[model samples]
Target: MMRRIGLLIFLGLLATLLIFPAVRAEEKKTDGQMPSLTGNIEGGFRLVDVDGSRNKFREHYNLDTGPRLLNLSLNGNYRSSRILDDFRLQANGVGGDPYQNYSLLVNKDRLYTFEASFKKSDYFYNTITYPVSRPDGNQTSFEEAHAFGTSRENTDFKLTIKPENLFKLTLGYSRMEKEGTTFLTALTTAVPPDVTLITTPVDEIDDFYFASAEFSLSIFDFYFEQDYRKSDNKLNFLSDPTANAAVELHESQTVKESLQTLRQPISRAKVHTLLFDKLDLSTNLVYSNSDFDVDINRPKDQFQAVRPPTTGEGSLNKKIWIWDMEASYSLLNSLTVHGIGQISELKQNGNITFTGSSRDTTEDGTVINKIFSHTVGAELEYVPLKDLSLNGGIKRQFRKLDFTRISQFNPPPPIENPVILQSGDTIYTLGFFWKPLTSLDFMGRVLIGEFNNPYTNISSTDTENIKFRVRYRPLRTLAFSATHAERNTENTTTFFKSNFKSDGISIGYQPVAKLDLNVGYTLQEGKSFSFFSSADAACFAFNPDAVNLCGGVNGAFVAEYQARSNILSADALYAITKKIKVGLDVRNIESSGTISFHFSDLGVFLGYLWPYNLETKLKYQWITYDEVVLNANDYVASVVTLSLGLNF
Candidate 1:
């Protein structure tokens, strides 16, 4: 509530300032030219219609293009040297399944500025029909119920002050509200049949406050910032039709309610400076704290005593602190060196209670997760000729995690035990740019990285990446470009390795002054091998009777797959007349793998401009999707849109 009042007051001040005229319309300009507002206001209305399967179309595409609606679009700008230096506002919205946005900005000289904006969106969750098989090798189709939908709104306001050359300040605030219906699953397997399937209605709100200031002088600059946020959520669970029969068995208490809240605060300080014109340094420190609380209410009549809500009435508190310093030095005319050191510490403590029929029990504990890291690197550049340059760099990073977990659930073992985890990586990179001819250019780079983790002895990885690009413009109206990239990761943990490679090319041609054409194609392929770990809990459940099948420390190779994909896209636009233009875009994507699928879409539009600043546009698009293994989910959609606009 306070945030809303603050925002309102801020806007009120801007409104008051806007009431005064910047200057008289008849006033003469100092430069011997009349001063007037130079901006265009455009108003438009759009008509959209959807065809084909609603379920498939609605899910695959945004609702604005899938439904019938009358939309509005407005944009304008104003500037003056008197009361306000610059001002702008924009608003647009769709009527049906409306998504709306509004924003305004005003600036006076270079000292003060104000901004406000709001946005909202509506979403839908449609039901689906699929085949449901029975244990007796029988299959039947079932249509799921239509669940509830969701809506969200957000608002933001900001004020800036730059009164002097040495210091500047900015203050901003934002709020968000979300309300929707969501599916809820039972927490325990012991719930009654009717309570297994439920729906949760949700209403949540979040607020944020931010403030930052910066001061600079000569070669030194400093910044200080703070941020605070709060959130509250209320949720209620109710039995759905699937659980209707079970609801009758327990009629007294059929609803559960939960309330949750979170509060967080963060602060940061940073400083940067250059010394002797040869070395540049910067440092930053940050601290953040968060508090979370949740309360649940369950009817005693509906739920049994054994599952008494797991009632937790306590709050959790967590804190994090981070500090980092970075430095760069110009070692020579063609070389520079850079290094950074950073550390982060995190701590969390919480206590929770479980309500039982006899009494309530409480468990409390704390955890510390700390990380220290360092990085150093150097870069070199050599230009022997005007058209050729070579660049190379190498960086090494080391990190250590001193983590301690001593909670009620994970008590420390006896006999003085300690554990620490450490990991780091080294990276090397080299690249070059060469222009052999006036119309030809080439660029390429290579990167290699070696990494180790706490489990490095058992599992580690090395990665290599290479990319090259070339462009040629032999003609004034034509250009061609091509690129190739490859990456591979080799893991020693369990004979796991993966590789990806891609090649693409594009051509742009301007046959005439009013026409342009562009086409591009890409091909990608990937291969990987993965071993299934028997230690996974799911393995035990899958083969309980035959433990030897997949229940050992050294799991067997369970999966190996290769994936390949191709993408082709083209666009062409032409100006038939001074007031008319037409354009077409086409895209096709195909994939082959264990999970193979294909998608393609084509769109065309025609635009016309009439006298008196009037304009009209007509667009049509078609999209299709196909699945080799699951054809039931494939569908096609055709859309048409028409819009009219007027500019003043």
Candidate 2:
């Protein structure tokens, strides 16, 4: 078995050290006669304890709330003059609980290199609620009572070879596996609206293989890469009314199963050359193709009660291509010019078929899309004074898109009108950097742009963006900085218009050599207005003739909203002695708008260093998260962690 072979190899590697005599104290320094092998090994262990709901805390930090091993890590490297110039190994877990990560690497000066790694992570979706609208226009809610989450494992291996100065090759492989609990909601066609929350099990696996080559010469460079990926995803859901009775199942118990597979191949090539010292040129091309197949089986039909093991099958094929070229030239010692042109094309074809005891149907479609863009820019940098430096840049860009779709049936698309979605924008930017004195510095930038959708005259927009920063260091121990940024978009379209602005200031001071302090605050604000159009009315309203409009030609204003956010933070660190230090940090953030939330964290830590490369640290943190509109989701918790490390 592979496991046995791996274990034997690991043990053999560990045994080699016994025959190699211990490094003598006098041989710490490298002498010219022999190759010196030197490396450091450090191991750390941490313990975490939480006082409140473990799931709540775990959702945020991905750590166990109760007693758990935070980390048991080891890393080391050995170097020799032989073929194996360097060999390194790192491990972070005991492979028992929560997660694990491990990696191994080997390198030879210019011949070859190899690496392998494995990692695992967990994800949780704690809150899932279902809301139903009543006849009176009120909404009723039902929340999931069971825990839902998933865990993923990933593995990667790679090898590289470079036998000569002009050529190099690389090969790699990776795999990922995920297992989890998922939730789904369903509706019954009963007179009195009925809802069912279905708990499901999910299993997925993905694998990828890739290879690349590089060629370099005095005047030219070329690189090529290609990769293929495959994935299998499956889900199964079965119902038990007795266990989770948010509702009473009138019909047969629910059962569902679904599976999907995807295959993708991607490739890219790049070539660049230095025509001259002042001008450099590069070109790149990329292509990708993807195929997907899916199958689903359910006990009962979604639209009707009849069930003959309703089944559905679908498949999709997608292909894309991209090409780009760029060039840059140094017109002067302090000025430079650059330009880039790019083109992209995408094509997709898909079909789906459904069969049941009473009904059968099929739908198919194909779409083709393309985009072209060109950009040119130049930058200037000059230092007119010894303490002052000015820098600015201007760029112009043009872009266009074309799209077409053919389908057997009409369905609501992402863009109602493809022509209306095709757009182009022109942007300009300029900025300056000035440092008049050692204690003072300033930087500012301005951007202006215009967007036009030629198919529809009403869908154009004008944009303005500005940002500035200033820093003043009035004293040797204290420094202050402030920043302001704003972006305003004025849309002539019927969709929406918005403005966003942010201002912030920060200060850092070290009154004494051993103590340091930092504090900062930021404010962000935004305003937007949504105006409905005739097309929107035709899509959203049942009776467009019975409504008053914005200007009689277009629909009315749907909403006008303003949002604001404030954030404040402070941190302090003090060194009690050369080997001991203490630090504290506090942060508060609150946002109010169409969506509102508030979050805060306060933490304190203490660290100590001892002889023989030993260190210890203790930290405690308090965190709070709240949704202003939904107080039931509010959570506050405290966590404490202690870690100890030793180096050999």
Candidate 3:
């Protein structure tokens, strides 16, 4: 029903646009003058052909063949009218495409203005691989295969009154919806748990309304806004009985879940001021409160022999507050200083209850959680010369978390003790920009930081990053640019480390007035080390002493992987004649590591401009993708598009 409504609205707008030009033309003929309506409309058709796996092609690029409204733009002005002054309309990708957008704007010459827009997008994901042998001679692979896809839509409308320089009032409303199907894996409740694959369908919607006011004065500006939001979500999981039918003592089950949330009101305020023409200051603040309710239902099945059908209910109340301030001042003729500070806090409280055929429990004990954080930073910029500028800054951040949980038994056991954790980080940064020559420029920046988090092994204790770039344009028709970046991080407690480096360069040439050419290349390398435990080793180890040495029978071991990638691209365009042009583009990407792949794309286009405000274009594209280990996932595709446009 919603999709039908959206289509109706779009068709109505399109009809109005098509008739506007005719009406304006009639008026122009009567007045013996040109009309004020001006713009262009373009429409096209697309064709697609695939030689390999169609699922892989869809997963990589979700484009389909169809008739499409490529683009449209229309603008009209009424100079002698008293109620309507000007209006504009625009649309793109309007027919049977993966993505579409439309917008309209109208103004009444200082009294009021209104705007509306709509957008839709589609997503797809599908990848299947065969089983492989593990290092310990155990087979490891996914037990199920499926394709997942979804679509999302967004709509918005806004209006403003007295939209001038001094003060303006605005009201707006927006909605977002997502619906699709996916896959999930669950474990049965038996002694030796069995894995089961389930198909899941999801639906979600969110809506928001807001009002805002803005005021501007001689040396200061003020702004304030208030908003409200509501959300609804539903999910269904259906078990595949045949997923584990061959395995012994396996059963299938299904589940249903729903959630509803509301945020009554959210408030925001901001202020900006300039003092003495040398000092600038700004501050902003926001606060919001939300409530959520959730329900889950599980049916009785073969796996639930010891238990009956179960139902659960949960509720949560959350609140958050944030504020930030910034200021900058000129200390000398060649120096400036800036400072920034921010603080935020979040709190949540919730409870849960469950009921079944054999048991009924209402654990009303509330679960509470809290988080707080703050940051401060300062920087100074100095320009000692007309061609050189330097800046440096330091920042520090601190955070703390506290939470408590209660047991889910009848009468609710005693509330557990509250747990607290704290973490912090400090960073220093320096940057410089220099333009010593008329045709040459250079820029660079560096950062160093230290972090402390004793509660988690994945946290890094120290980190460093550096980046540099340079550009040279020795002549009017030729130019060159290069960039390099590096990052390193390590955890001292767990002996975990990672590093990344990248470099790129590009050159552009236009030796002739009618031709243009460009080429570029980039290389990237990265590596990381971490620890993991293998279940096969844990089940095979028998000696008690050996088990103790293997991380308490988990057989934990260090794992490492390295990856490198190279990318190359080239393009050219030439004006073959006075009314015709041709262009070509090519790109290739290759990577080698734990998982290797290669991708190539080639495109060509031809454009022609005819007499009497008419234009036509033709384009073709070819793409190929290959994986070194998963040959079944490889695919090749070809696409062609033709378009025509008319201007008035």
Candidate 4:
């Protein structure tokens, strides 16, 4: 509550300064002529995959796009009747994207104001990894990478107007698209590894719209904005994973397919106002919706028999909605308070059209799901002395979820076939913040929750956090600081679970405007083998059996990661020109436990800061994983990225 009130006063004073015409705009005339326009462009790439013999970076959720890009502006005049007008172009125009740009901003001023921009990034080359075992019945030894390529394009435009400077309105639109493909043969499962898994191709796209209003005057000021966005992602999930659909291999095998669709929609709005000298208030609202669609064609008792297949198509669709609202009020002179609250609803309403060759398998798949939640909180801030202040807050959070599954295949075939699952939990929290010295900062928050009903462990855990940092400059060209942060999550999936924790500190120094250097270390701790999956645990229920995998010193899958780790990295930037700059960044990660993994990243890029200016950039990224093991599967690759943009 206090935080909101404080910020309210801050905005009140800011609006007073703006509408009073007392503030000076930063503009300078150059030799009585228009200023010349200038800017640059950059792009780069990188590949990350599991470390091993078959090291390709291909898998679900492609991230291997070698090239990333940026679009922007520098030295822009927000109040010009005649805005920027410019041109420049570059590259082979690969993927229909020129490393540079060509543009013209002209026309007259009107009640309606408009702005537009475009961005395109060069190709992406990457891969991901999965575990593998040799025919020799060996437990470990092979690794592979799935090579993928990428392409992307985006654009946006907006228009606004104020017939009266005291009342303004605006509207805008945007679009984005991305696509990628694999570069290998379909030997996806060949021993010694076949390249077949790389045969799938996928692409995604999105469109958006926005509208808002803002007004200002000497005695009063008001602000408001509303936006609605919708996006749909598509993919052809595998209907079957078996090598031969006509022949069954395992008696009780798990069916694998990627038949799912995700759709998202979001609407948001905000309103704020300032009065006389001491009062201010604001209210904000947001609504979000997610639509889920799943389709699966399978033979009943899909795992049991090769003959007499119970095959058909089934789908489950779900929708979720969320609402959030926040408001605050403040008195300008001294004391202040604020509060915020939110509620969420996940409701599913859909149908599953079913099709099959036989009547026994012909059934419409329909189901419903719902989740409800609420969160409320408030805070207070008091200044006891000119340079001293105190802050505190209390919050309550609650969540409830219910899932009901209805089907005609129930063995008993009852009158009303429905499966219901109910879950919920409540939490209490406390927080504090103190800044006793100009160079010192402190903050802390603690939360505890009890659950009679909970859907996931992450949703009902008790947590704690504490952090501190200090910055001091002993000389004009030299400065340094240290910081430590840690977090703990309890009441995990089970009582056997141990909290996760990490602590770290670092020192940094900068001797010039173009150079920066810093180094730091962190230690991480986690739970052990008892945290393994129930099925994997049952494998070691016996002492001798357990020793083979979890043994006395180390357990199994749950204990595979190290408990303590350290990281060392340094980032730096150098200005090539007032409008252009270059950067270099590197990091090294090391672990203390036997299962710990070590890795590193090296990045280099150039940045351009010209407004509505086409900028092109090149980037190179390299990564090395599991540095401790002398395993040949340990591999490296080079990625190159090219990008073009205008105020992106």
Listed in order, each prediction's TM-score against the native is 0.75, 0.73, 0.84, 0.61
Of 1 and 3, the candidate ranking higher by lDDT: 3
Better of 2 and 4 by lDDT: 2
Clash pairs of candidate 3? Answer: none
Score residue 155 of candidate 4 by CA lDDT: 61
lDDT of 4: 0.48
Better of 1 and 3 by TM-score: 3
Decreasing TM-score order of the candidates = 3, 1, 2, 4
Clashes of 4: 56
On a 0 to 1 TM-score scale, where does candidate 2 land against the true structure?
0.73
lDDT of 2 by residue, 200-219 (tens): 67689999999999998778
**Clash totals, every prediction:** 0, 0, 0, 56
RMSD of each candidate?
6.9, 6.9, 5.6, 11.3
- lDDT against the true structure, per candidate, is 0.67, 0.67, 0.75, 0.48
Query: Which residue window of length 10 is worst by lDDT in model 2?
Result: 18-27
- Writing each residue's lDDT as its tens digit, candidate 1 over 462-543 gives 8999999999999999999999999999864435679999999999999999999999999999998654543355433423
Error of 4 at 536 (Å): 11
lDDT of 3 by residue, 21-68 (tens): 654666565663333677889999999998876667777777889888
- Put down candidate 4 lDDT per residue, 1-648, tens digits, no spaces: 123323333433343344223212222332223333344334333343433433322211224444443332232223432232222222222223324221212222445444454555545343233233333343331123334455555666666776636577878887776665433222232344333222334456677777777776565455555555555544422223432221111122333333445555555555556655444555555565556555554433322223233333443444444555554555444456767777777777566554442444445545666777777777666666655555566666666655544445323352334444444555555555556666555555555554544454333344655555556555665555655555555444343334556666665667677666666666666543333322256433432233344332321323233357677777777777877878888888777664456677788988676556556565676766653444432545445565655542
Better of 1 and 4 by TM-score: 1
